[model samples]
Target: MSVVTEPKLISGNANKPLAQSIARRMSMHRGMSVGLVDARVERFNDQEIFVEVYENVRGEDMFIIQPTSNPANDNLMELLIITDALKRSSADRITAVIPYFGYARQDRRTKARTPISAKLVANLLTEAGVDRILTLDLHAAQIQGFFDIPVDNLYASPVFALDILHHFRGQLDDVMVVSPDVGGVARARELAKRIGAPLSIVDKRREKAGEVAGMTVIGDVSGKKCIIVDDICDTAGTLCKAAEVLMEAGATEVHAYISHGVLSGPAVERITNSVMKSLVITDSIEPTEAVKTARNIRIVPTAPMFAQAILNTWSGTSVSSLFETDTLVPIYEGMYSRD
Candidate 1:
């Protein structure tokens, strides 16, 4: 329970479960109350978004919980409308609590003359009168620099580490941590140090989106159980391809721990046919029907991490430690840097 000084909670149509959990954690003290306004959000004739808040919000600190995950445009519009409604009603401050920020991968222009949509999204949020931003495990860490407001980026590795320790119990040496691509080396190395396991990397020559060439393994993965970790899993192509590479490198078993599972466009079918024994993803964003019913996909509830983060944020505490890496095994010096 956090000692909340003063604040009120308001939620949108997106991600109600996470909102409720945050509300419960932040409201653990006295002299503070929070409630969500019944929002009537609808699309008009030309698919334009319309919204109305059905309650009073005068002088209240408002937090709108929405994950711009699936149907990215609609969810982003919903968040904008929610902020505008609260602002017009004389709310003291408005905070956009997005667990999964979509359009994060477009942080830069890789192709010639392409747009940086992440910066555009940041501009829209600022124009919508959002005073602060709270999100988790962005695909690109640099996305935080795009926001003009105070941005708190939380991490879920601590939550995942505890679950992994529970899964492996006393035997930690048989495990090996792997990053799906070279870009995710930091995340993979951190997890490897946590479990006292060795690290491996995937060398993927990506020809195009949803297409990667399985070249070779970069570390010692032979005869070890492989655990691939990543920040986002969009089409599942990178994940499945990396899994197959680990198998070819003599990994006895393969599993994955991904944060936001944006399983889009035939991802489930491909993951079902992949060699990985299981793929575990967090519920930062709501799971679609395909992901919820997938045979190989398993969801690890992030309720506790969300709860703790909400508590810390409301109480004006440091959340930077939560952003650090995690492990159950003692950290070996050269294996990974503890700094």
Candidate 2:
């Protein structure tokens, strides 16, 4: 018989609340005390990051929860330095749990001289000594190929689907899931199937970054309540434009379910003025005050999903089963009910 070792959970400066929530869930599931690693992640006067693991992690399985969110460079560096610290401390394994992967939208080169920043970020994590990666809803699926180590890309579709059910309360026949652009049709289709709704796509032309020149509805959304779905909503330009086109095409109501809410610059303002009734985003990235103050935006916590994923990873079990949308409602309701 082999031995079973307890895993150690650590958190970087990014998204501390989410890390804490996951730690609690893990502890609850174990029915024993599971604690987070006590560590200090700070910066120097010259802005160099420093990380210290206060406890001995020698031979222990280590998982660091750090979303490469805003202040992307700093959070990214923190993740790297924390991984290096755990590696130097002789941890048996290191898995970086990135709830929101930054620079993911730059996965491909639209122009000849453009750099593929997503691959560069992946290379940095591997070189920083990460044995595996756990992330949610990568902007591009092909980004998994950039990593040499095992990468588990979790989906937020189940979470969104559950919320949709609760929001609409079994009135899904008139609802339709829409892809904001051609690239996101697959994700939208999966979500539509999960929610038992129709599927539609918006054909769009991007004149430049953070700008959508035009959008055309590809399917019949007439008299249907459209739910635009996508992975990220950075500047909210495309989302707003899509909503307009969908409404023009006679959608009864327009809402959106996007995974990451980067909400940079005029995003909140744009969303506030858009035709969308509500913009539901996951709490993968820590929300800013502007997000909290946005009237039309609502946040769904992803902590339970991520917590279960961490537990499964530590036990060497497949987490893909948890990805099924049908399993989400009960899991989410149970977890939140206890709170």
Candidate 3:
């Protein structure tokens, strides 16, 4: 008989609530004691990150849950330090669970003499001794190739689909899934298929970052409710502009569903004054006070999906089943029993 090892969960200062939620779900559903590893992560007098694991992790499977969200540099440094600590402690396997990978948007250099920062971050983690990586909805799917170790990219489509159904409740006939840009058509199309809706693309031209030159709706959205889908919503510039264009093109109602809500800068203010009815996002990144107070923003919990993925990874089971379900209730029931 093969022996199954329970993986220990750990968290840094970045998004601790999400880490706790994942750990709690795993313990409740798997009928086992899945506890967070005790650790101290703080900055020194000069703001240098320090990490120390209190519990013995020697020869133990460990998963560190930390998202490179706000204060990106600080959080990223903390993750690297945490991974190094785990390695020195002799952990059998270390998986860096980054729900929202920062610098992922810089996957490739678009201009002359620019750097591919995404690859640099991947190299940093690998060098820090992370045995594997588990992230959600990378900005560019090709970013997975940047890492040398095993990378499992989870999706937020399942969570978003469930919320859409419950919110609309059998009245999705006139609903349409829209891609905010040509590059995101694949992601939008997949979500549209899951919800049994048609797909539309926003043909947009960007002159530079956080600036939209022009946008046009490619498909017929006349008198239909539209849901713009994308992997990340950084500045809300493109999304807000796209929503305005959709409304002008005769969309009855406009909404957005994105995997990561990196709502930086004036995103909250922009969304509040835009035509989008609501901007639904997954809890991959911790929301700011502005996001929480925004009347047009709703957050969908992704803990259930992440919890099952962790279990599957520890047990060497396929984690792809998580994307096949519209709702997460069955996954929360421990669908792949280890008995």
Candidate 4:
């Protein structure tokens, strides 16, 4: 553990409640509120963002909380401006605490001439003056290498996995861990191992943009309770389809454990109509009213884990043991009554 002195707390206009929650959990007071010049965001006709940090942040260790969720461009820009503001203010360290990192799904160019937006987002953040980055549950693991600075790709698996294990107790056997797509097999496997469950894969193909329906099952799901896992459920298109496929493939129950519920567009309606028994998502991103009130959708919090991470980081402690070994081993150890 490296000694980090004089860490500061600076937050953007995104996910204020979650920021406050994290700060509260850390048992720290907000150094100073970054106020706006104008209460109403009255912008010029050009639609350019206007930003001003009212408080001074000179020589501070600054941590900015912003979830680049809906209105991604705006929220992302706000984060950048906050970072730039902190950097210009001579903050000793500027850590961007983004709970939900947007544009992470496009890590590679799937088609000819397509942009690798994930890399672009990383470059943009780096260019925007983020000294180090702390985020949760990136869609792709390799995105950590995209940043030159020390990047912390936190996992929501522990939070969700532990919660599911406690909720379902001994009814875990015959439960299948499912990856909605092939890309998420590693993450799904981790969660599956944690819960002491077998694994399954959903072979899916996207028909068109903003549409995801399942095609076939790659593993046996007969007479099993299926928990479909994915990093982000943007429109619930893929998850809805996966649940339907699992249920159709003789799965007794089809549940989805997603980390971030961006749930844009018709996501709420889609999940409402899907055959899934329940949809578990984290509060990494804020939930809309429809999502909040939805009966099937449940939110697990990442605050405790993230709060612990922040405290551990500030305290020069090693959090490397956090889900370091295959999450499944310890999970199954707890299962089967094994030490």
Error of 3 at 191 (Å): 0.5
Clashing pairs in 1: 194-327, 194-328
Candidate models: Cα lDDT each: 0.78, 0.89, 0.89, 0.76
lDDT of 2 by residue, 49-84 (tens): 999889988888899999999899999999999999
Model 3 regions lying over 4 Å from their true place:
1-4, 326-329, 332-339
* Candidate 4 lDDT tens digits, 1-339: 333444445566667677766766555323434322121222457877666666666666678878898888888988887777667867667778899998888898889999999889999999988888889988888899988988888887776677677777778876889988787899999888877789889987777886664478999999998998888887787778778778888999998888899898899999998898899998888888999999899987666566666656666676554554343334233432222
Per-candidate TM-scores read: 0.88, 0.95, 0.95, 0.87
Error of 2 at 15 (Å): 0.6
lDDT of 3 by residue, 140-173 (tens): 9999999989999998887777677767666699
Q: Residue 156 in model 4: shift from native, Å? A: 1.2
Ranking by TM-score: 2, 3, 1, 4
* Tens-place lDDT digits, model 1, residues 210-260: 677556789889888889999998888888888988998899999999999
The alpha-carbon deviation from the true structure for residue 83 of candidate 4, after best TM-score superposition, in angstroms, is 1.0
* lDDT, model 1: 0.78
